[model samples]
Target: MLVFLNQRLVVFSTPKCGSTALEQALAPMSDIVLQGDPRIKHCTFHRYKWRLEKFLQIFDDTPMATTALIRHPQDWLGSWYRYRHGSWLDGTPQSTKGLSFDQFVEAYLAEEQPAFAAVGSQARFLTHPKTGETVDFLYRYDAFDEFEGFLEARLERQFDLDRVNTSTEMRLSLSAHLAQRLETCCEGDYALYDSAHAPRPKSRMRAFMQALAS
Candidate 1:
């Protein structure tokens, strides 16, 4: 993620997204600085809250903006699981320790239930702590090409995606039951992605005709 801090362009990095590439792009520039996400603290009550407010203070409201790249939930979950467990889609243990994908998915899906909902609920750049207003201009992890253009236009500089570790391969390739469970569990993320990548009118009409022919 990238943002303008006190008239100097800065990068606010998230864990996965293409922060590595963005960090590389801004390296040569003296004005642009890179800052990692401050929400990684276990103490959300005090340390996290203080860090967030301090981050917000860096922007004095003079045309300040922040950019974040979000990946598909399934892919994100898969990567997180693999990083923790060091295992593939199968149950074979690749790592010394970590929860299985099934276990993570089950707990993630159950987050919608009463007690679990607030457990995983954490704030990001888009979220406002005091006003509860979510900032806009969020980009998709799937559409890196378009996002690159957005960065160039916004920052007035070209950005290269070469240094990033982005892979097109789907990780989990969920089975029927797992897919259904995911769809039900991650409904909100799915809807957001749908709205972001909604088909054009022409494409929609073409798909409609194709469906009719079938």
Candidate 2:
């Protein structure tokens, strides 16, 4: 997470959402940068509210507004699968070597996922612990240009994104049955992603809907 105290802004590091590159680009301007460990780096909505928010209150007059990004649920899962398949994890139980992407996804949909496919739910990350509160600003992960514009306007500074933490690319197809199961299991993530596109221009929103349908 990157917190700009004077600006009352916090750019939350959503997993697999180019947050590493964002932090690298913006860290110099932030008052606090929590990263390195995954837990610290990906400070979720609940963790921030229950722990960090109170600590930050000592230094601020008002609560900081959070900004984050979301992606299609399948895309998010694919990223995790590819990331775990990286050679760096070859010896670790987290490695996805030898597993098909469909199999990895199957593991994820299990009642209890193993380490390799235990990528947590995105909905749980963004929603409030009890109240289901969402971030003040949520953007589609692909909509970096608009997200950057919002940040630039608030911070009054220009910025750019660099590709970072990207994983290997491969075409993997899922069975229709498993795809249906995934739809049911990750419904919350789908809903949250859909919400991010609201209030978009008619042309853009229509195009987005078409893309989703396709």
Candidate 3:
């Protein structure tokens, strides 16, 4: 996660959403950059608002504007499958080397997911559990330029981002039945991505402030 104190912006790093590239590009310009562990590096918006932001209040009282990037659920799952299939993870329990994309996705949607398919939901990362509030800004992974442009304007800096931690390129296809199941299981992810275009609601802002105060 990258926090720009002057900008009052907190960019949550959503998995498989090109966050690594953004971090690398903006780290030097950020006031605080979290990159020690996966858990801390990719801290969720809800967690930061409820937990970490209180600590930051000693330094700054500025209400942070949270942002994140979200990808299509199917494509996001495909990235995880391909990433685990990489040579570095060849013999690990997280490896998806011998599995087809459909098989991987099936395991992901299972009641108890296997290690290789246990990636957490994007919706859950961005939403507050009790209030059902999401980040202040969300950008679609497919429309990366839109997000980049907004970030540049907000930070007043040009970004030179290189694609980092990209998975292997392959044409991934899911069976119709499996695709339907995935859609049903990840409906919240799809809904949240769709809602990104709308303005943040007053209730969401109120809930966020309440959470911060609590």
- The TM-scores of all predictions, comma-separated, are 0.60, 0.90, 0.90
Pull out the clashing pairs in model 2. none
Ranking, TM-score, top scorer first: 2, 3, 1
Worst 10 residues of 2 by lDDT: 197-206
Tell how far residue 64 is off in model 2, in angstroms. 1.5
The order by descending lDDT is 2, 3, 1
Report the poorest 10 consecutive residues by lDDT, candidate 3. 195-204
lDDT of 1 at 56: 55
RMSD of each: 7.5, 4.4, 10.2
| Model 3 TM-score relative to the real fold | 0.90
**Global local distance difference test of model 2:** 0.89
Cα lDDT listed for each candidate: 0.52, 0.89, 0.89
Per-residue alpha-carbon lDDT of candidate 2 for residues 71-141, written as tens digits (9 for 90 to 100): 88898898998899899999898999999988999999989899998889889999996998989999997
Which residue pairs in candidate 3 collide? none
